[model samples]
Target: MAAEPNETAQVNEIQKEYTRIDKDWLSLHYKISIGMVLFALAVECIMGLILVNTDMLNTTVPKFVFKFILVPSGVNGLCAVIDHMVVKSEKISQTAKIYTVSIINTVICFSLFTAHSAFTVTYYVFVTAIILTTVYASYLVTLSTSVSGLALLVISELFITWDVDKPTIFQSTLRLGNFLIALFIMFSVSMICMVVIHYEKRKNRASIRIEEERITLTKRLKMDELTGIYNRKALHDAMRDLEDCNPQDNYIFGITDIDKFKNINDSWGHQTGDKCLIAFAQLLKSNCIKANVYRYGGDEFCIIFHHTDINEAYETAVLIQDQLKKVEFKEYPELQMTASFGLAQYGSGMNAARLFMSADQALYQAKITRDAIRIHEKEI
Candidate 1:
């Protein structure tokens, strides 16, 4: 039952599409959240600055501070908003983390400016806020973001202390007294938080990878190796699951058997036989809408339908078999393929296994006639 080249290629294309859609969904969520956070931070900064610099403070705003801090922070915030919009449009996830860090850095700028103003005591609040931001970043790219945050902190210190007296030297000289100790404490906390965040991110990533592998393995297990249809094992599970459910009136069961399959293999070799099977499976997959198709065994296939009547199932089978006219083998130009179908519907008491057995018996009757459709009740 090894798949034909065309069928295999089609399956690969479908898998790739599934992966792309999944990636885009995750990217959309992250991008929207990033955009919201950036917008909120920008509003807070713009409004807070305007209020603080206004007569509400009853003091003249420092022009140098406004020029140095407000302009840079606003531009940074705007860049985050633009980056977020780009992510939304392009569905790109690679730059999401970088944009997040830039947004957080704007908040850091606001803190630096506040600390340099009359509220030098707000440095404690800034220290706490920055530590939290760095921890969030550690979850994204632990070591890299942590290093960038450290560099940004250094830059902020330079900006605040520029053109000021030398008394505020908290690093190396420790002239800021206990504030230098507080700085050391903050750095220590940041390092420890980053390590914790790093480990958590590593573990989460490993878990996600394991889960993805498990899903792939589960799919492979259920699929037939040759034809890419559900294998007998999956059929067994599907039947058992149906047995556990409440009986429904609209379920239809069907079986398809390749006509003169042994003669086909003997005449054209096993490779061509495989091509025929792949072609049939591909056809069933395409046309068996609202039904679960399985490779029962050998040259036998099955379709179980939900909410379908016996006549609808029969019409579908006829339509699918008629497509056999178009099936062309490269080596055998004169060969035509056909399948006999057995159709049945479930009653209130019938389990899926019983339902399919009835269909199997009908399929056997169809096989006797060669290329025919037989209702299980008609055979009985």
Candidate 2:
């Protein structure tokens, strides 16, 4: 059987609500991720400049090493800008590509810094150890952190093997101790960042789920149990909406009631009468495509048509009456049912309640006159 008009409308509303929520979530996530990447890049640039100019490091490091560090750091900053632009506007694939480029740039920085021979054997070892720590730290910032970690581990091992015995102020044990401390700090920072990201994602997911549940519950509350159509509450809600409608837009109000409903219940039992009502509601829903159908109460339904003229509304009412002639009520083979329709078109200064009353009075007139449908026209 066809669904009632109100049920279909509710389903459409739910779909629109979910689509809106998902789009908003995706837009927000992109903006946040982009902002974070940009901020990280800005900080890195400032730190690089400070380190290059500071008295403590400027005199100690060679010009070549200084240039090497600055150049790659600049390149990494540029790549971060590109990442921010792409990630803020595109899907996950774009974000993944940006991250991939970022890792490659980081690799270039590691290679440049490690190849320089300015450091004493102990200092070189310490630098290699820092690179390895950074590689592991990268994993916390990125989904592909493990790949970076493995690459750094291999590079560090190779560098250490190549430079086994050069003289330095510090012994190997002290260098090792410093390396361990640096690694511990890097790992701790990365862990903190990862925890924050995970928590935010969890919170967003929970909010989306709660919103979906609320929409579902609201729909159920407004729906009629038998015909799966909008109940009396839904009619009131729609009527309330009419108050703010633009005056230029046409509106049609209709009320429909099943003919001889009580007699059907008395002669064929209430169950069969229910089946008839359900079937008839489906008929109204299927026929009235441009209308909002509501179950006003037992054996009575209402429809409101937005942007409809009097002639079109009357045509629709006639179509619905004709459509009911074909419904095959299987339980009572001899039973035939019809609906009476009353319609009113909106005019200046007509409120929703008054419009509904006008339609209801016309519906009463149709029932009294035994006509299939009646339309209320404003007096000339």
Candidate 3:
């Protein structure tokens, strides 16, 4: 099934974050691999010294050099080359990079197993590599690496002879059976890790859904349902924001009212009056691109202009009044409308309330003339 656009967007955001996390993990893995190689070299050197001193060495000295020294070094060198290629190349897919890391880890662990075949404890390296793959939080990578590790363990059992004490065929069979039990345990751990990762991703998706809903609800609360402009609540919020803003920034506030709006309701009914209000709000929204328009109350509107010229604001008010006069109400073609507007510019040290009061005062003067525009004069 196709995802909804919003859901798709959310998923994209989550994937991007995971990509960043994977990149960091890749870097850490590279650094740790270098350290592990150094440690492995040190252990092999010590083991060689102990075999020589204790006279427990079974293989020729040159064969021992090839097996213990050269083989491990070649494997480590190959890993370094692959790591550099995968990490630096931009063309490699993200899935490929993750798989490369898992493969490298498996190969390194297998190398350790082959180097110390006599030590049954080295078999646990496969299990360790499987567990480390879980940090990527990818079920596919974890499962694939687990299967690969199991395969390598079985191959080592069949082909490679461990230099343990001479034992009967029955004892070797019993040891192989024990290793099979260990494989079962490794597979179980991988399943558990996959389940945990699946649940974590589900939880993250739920969180994203809840946050999206909250933002949608907030927008609805701030919007006017009737006319689709901002509501009085939004205007109040804007006023508070203006109060908190730098006092030196210039602002202009305008309050407007449809002239004789109550008479329109009385003569043509409230429904017709609603139509007029909606049309007026639409005009303001479409024309007043520089300002935020709000439905302050019944038949009244408010605008806040940031850093606008008083003359420009006054001219915009006139244009709105002219535009309103030209609108033909199809329901009542005989009906004509005009709006009165009052504008006030911000002054230093003036609070939002004071600035609002000044615009309201100008609105009162405009109302006296009816269908007029008035600019509040700053007090000397």
lDDT of each: 0.66, 0.62, 0.80
User: Could you tell me how far off, in angstroms, the CA of residue 45 lies in candidate 1 after the best superposition?
Assistant: 29
Best by lDDT: 3
Least well predicted 10-residue stretch by lDDT in candidate 3:
1-10
Model 1, span 221-243: residue lDDT tens? 98999999899987888777766
Scored against the true structure, residue 76 in model 2 reaches a CA lDDT of 46
Ranking by TM-score: 3, 2, 1
Off by over 4 Å in 3: 1-35, 77-103, 133-135, 140-171, 247-251, 288-290, 306-329, 370-373, 378-380
Q: What lDDT tens digits, residue by residue, belong to model 2 across residues 53-101?
A: 8764534445534444555455545655664565455555533543544
The list of candidate 1 runs beyond 4 A from truth reads: 1-127, 130-177, 184-188, 378-380
Give model 3's TM-score versus the native structure: 0.74
Model 2: CA > 4 A from native? 1-62, 65-70, 77-81, 84-141, 153-202, 378-380
- Candidate 1: which pairs clash? none
What RMSD, rounded to one decimal, does every model reach?
A: 9.5, 7.5, 5.9
TM agreement with the true structure for every prediction: 0.60, 0.68, 0.74
Q: In model 2, state the lDDT of residue 89.
A: 56
Clashing pairs in 3: none
- Candidate 3: deviation at residue 121, Å? 3.4
Better of 1 and 3 by TM-score: 3
